[model samples]
Target: MATYRPRVLIGNWKEDACLEEERLRDFMHKRERGELLIQKIDKLQDNLLKKIKLSVTKDGFVHFGDTVMLLNPDNKSSVENNPGECSRLTLAVNLDDISIHSAISLQAPCGVSATKSVEPMARNTFCILSVDGGAVDEPIRFGQNFCLGTTGGFSDQMLYLASDHKSFIRSAKKSYLQQVFLTDKLSYLTCWRATFLDPQLRLEYEGFPVPANSKIIITHCHTNRGLAVPGNFWVRSYFGKEYEVVCHTYLDSHRAEEDKNYWVIVTANPSNENGTMLDRPSPYPGETTKNEFHEET
Candidate 1:
């Protein structure tokens, strides 16, 4: 680990290569949403994913590393080549473990093809990071997704999207991946969710003028809670009339009882700048229990 601490994430890193036609179908059904991120990397053909085997141990150990060769799923004498052998691969990582960074490459003559395939491409990944922690203004909801605080919170965060929606549409659509990190001392201080809205229509209603700021409330409803699962995780939400719901669930073997949580009617909005959030009333009494988020401010 570096002197500067990195974010720790809870996600799965698995191998989806060299699959039997029938078995591959099973795997597809397993991590449909997670496969969306993998598909983005599949198009890039990076060495990071080449020749890797991922597994979970009985003692609850999740490991991700590389292997040189894999037995052909259908045969013995035949060997399968990892796509990394001859491609410039770009990884679309969804996990945020500070200790987890990978590099995969073949030695000697095999690396030539991989080296040549490293064509530079314009790209950016959206990430959530803590921005301002010092004294600023009272914590206020900016648009719908972020909260501003003088103490610690997401301020001046950056949002990066593909240059064009046409290209993005062709790639992974409707894929939701969440990465969470916490410091040893500061275990759980903050929480956040991302929402989308029409960037052009500033104000859609008569008297309710949309704030010039980045976030606006598309609807008011309940907070969404998701189900907890190991390995690959996928949660669902509904952007119904007057509200957008995002159910967040954390996975822990010991915390099996903390499953299927809800954030019923979370606020939502649109983003002309990058992405957006919706707003809800403060002190949602009875609706929630702990209100750690309310206390953070």
Candidate 2:
């Protein structure tokens, strides 16, 4: 089924977004648009946003089943005048693109039915209700895993984060939300671990409920590779230009490539038991909850 990212229409590029924005490399040098998105985030202090309670966890961390948006940090949104255009880059997995070279044949001794080679059209993620393109938010998290589906098998037809040498691109390992699956798919590749932001304290904080709206590193459990953006790399696809996301090692010193690995987390639009938006009571002495403000950031 077809899907649309809120305000980021899949194909067309507008003057406001296209002209005003720089190609990935150019923007890195200027850093002009990124700063704008940051200012917009600061303006999120509006009374309405401050009043709502978005996270369900008492501690405000995301829970196992929570639907959320995994966004690129320090990138800009496509919308004109959108605050993130200057402050952040709105990047996420593009289900429609990013394919693997060859699917791991499940019929082999180590393989399972789900990993077998299939016709290209057979495995596309159509009508998947989770994270349907933008941060309005909704991608269900499984036990440390997020599921993406294909018509051929099931939602379990995963976007695994394992290391594979058979990639169509030069990138060594991948978080396969791309168009095709590759050979060498192993059970361990499907595991992704969310760790605390600080590297020094990771083991102690691993698996704590991931905080909503916080920066995170989605380390592929099997290879210890961090999911990363490819230095504003761009490629042409059935859609317009698409940015590349890959599973990359942080180099032997373990500090290189850290710059491209940060991702921001935002939860889905949440509702209460009766299916209405949840209203959070303000804990501050003089504050009161009010209607929600729905501007995109």
Candidate 3:
């Protein structure tokens, strides 16, 4: 291929070979890639997200890699809310819950796809990691299907999210948490539900762009459960204190618990730019040439 020249047919009797050569030439010239500098690849995860002040965005949008806090704005819980405390998602699982540990054993079946290599993927759970230590920011689009990361926190701290469908074999209702990671293949395991504004709008909102700062849902696209925070489920961690973030659907009326799943994408860096009108962004279908992306700030 290095020696092959474009449109140069040096011989006859070459039918498919000529076409393939042309295709390769086009591929070599037509590849489009964008570079985004989000943060230092080796930067320490000192729970930087916790230091971000909870504030609204001016542009009212979120783009990829824009540091964000998945805030469950619902103050309905009886638990006390400190003025400066921000309870974001974390990888801390209830160590006492044996079922979760067992659930981790069965995670090999999660996110299985035809193209993805079949390998056992353990839950990102570890008792040593603090409840609010650090985590990757998940994606969302109102009235669109998506995914998030959970279990043990992702080490890469990049795009998209993963989850553990706890008790799929034991209970009828499945629960999952969204954890972020970089990947080329997308499947139902990464699919989370994001319905905001109006459910009725979904019918008319296909291909309609969603702005940032809009409250959206983070749930598995195929399950009744959604990403939720146990308001009262607090855990003492290496860092003072943090909230135990769980992915359980409200056993009662699903509609009543909508507030629990509410999340807003905030600007990770609000200096010169807010996020963007990209809260509901998706990659090109069948994209194979490096699908991972980050903010070009």
Candidate 4:
């Protein structure tokens, strides 16, 4: 008897999205033409299909013990020497899957597999869905929604943050969506709940000095369950050679009364010589100030 493979279905839907509205990196701009967009969409579909295969294959041997076909069978053993390899592969697959899913999510309300877990695609079974090239939708355009897939794997947010070239503003945008924006793949129960709200939690920022007469801001969102729960977050910014730390909190008086409402705090940092840090604000409140600092007075 032949082994079973899982069928992966991904979709795309434009939700009143305009490619031009959102700031596009120069590279994306060159590819913004109608044909290029179609080409990119098709390329994305092809990549996603490849990912589906790799995801299903990484499992090593596909076995149908009773029902479902498992992906990453023996993943632990094969990955022991390569602790992060499996996760990276899974992340790549998920990102491609999520990107494709975002493109077609609102098209016709099509149903994906019942669950996110790897499912069996019976032996000799195959299914493929593709988006044909054409004019962008009127109410909807390309690249409306962005996704990073489930939290089970490595986060694109982390990857972007760790990149040597990405600026704080760039990383912040991606982080906001990944951490705050509500999505089906994201869990409010597990994700939204503030995990590290500590006055002691240290924060740091580094890059370049801010220009004169500018400000920095920080923002934080929390649930109003009350009872402490890490209500404070800290931030640090780099000015020339030294880093300054600022600590703050987001209070919920109603949560104090009923112990039920969370508040998000956005804080700003001080201006520097160049105003690089000024452009990007802190996530918490009261963290910003107007003061110049030098190594030696």
Please report the candidate that would top lDDT against the real structure: 2
The per-candidate count of clashes, in order, stands at 27, 21, 17, 38
Alpha carbon lDDT of each predicted model = 0.22, 0.38, 0.37, 0.22
Q: Model 3, 80: alpha-carbon shift in Å?
A: 5.9
Among all windows of ten consecutive residues in candidate 4, which has the lowest summed lDDT? Answer: 237-246
- Candidate 1: minimum summed lDDT over ten consecutive residues — where? 66-75
| Displacement of the residue 172 alpha carbon in candidate 2, Å | 6.6
Over 4 Å off, model 1 = 1-93, 96-137, 142-170, 173-297
Error of 3 at 201 (Å): 4.1
Q: What digit string (tens of lDDT, one per residue) describes model 2 on residues 1-297? A: 325433565655363356446566575653555343333333321211122222344445555443334555543222233333333343322322112112221111111111111111222211222222323233233225532222223223433223433346533222343222222343544555565555555666544555665566766655666766544444543224555556664432544334456665543334453121112333554652221111221
Better of 2 and 4 by lDDT: 2
lDDT per residue for candidate 3 within 88-152, as digits (tens), equals 33232122222223321212222211011111112221111111222323223344553333322
TM-score computed on alpha carbons, candidate 2:
0.43
Candidate 4 lDDT over residue span 189-209, tens digit each: 111111222222213222222
lDDT, residue 6, candidate 3: 37
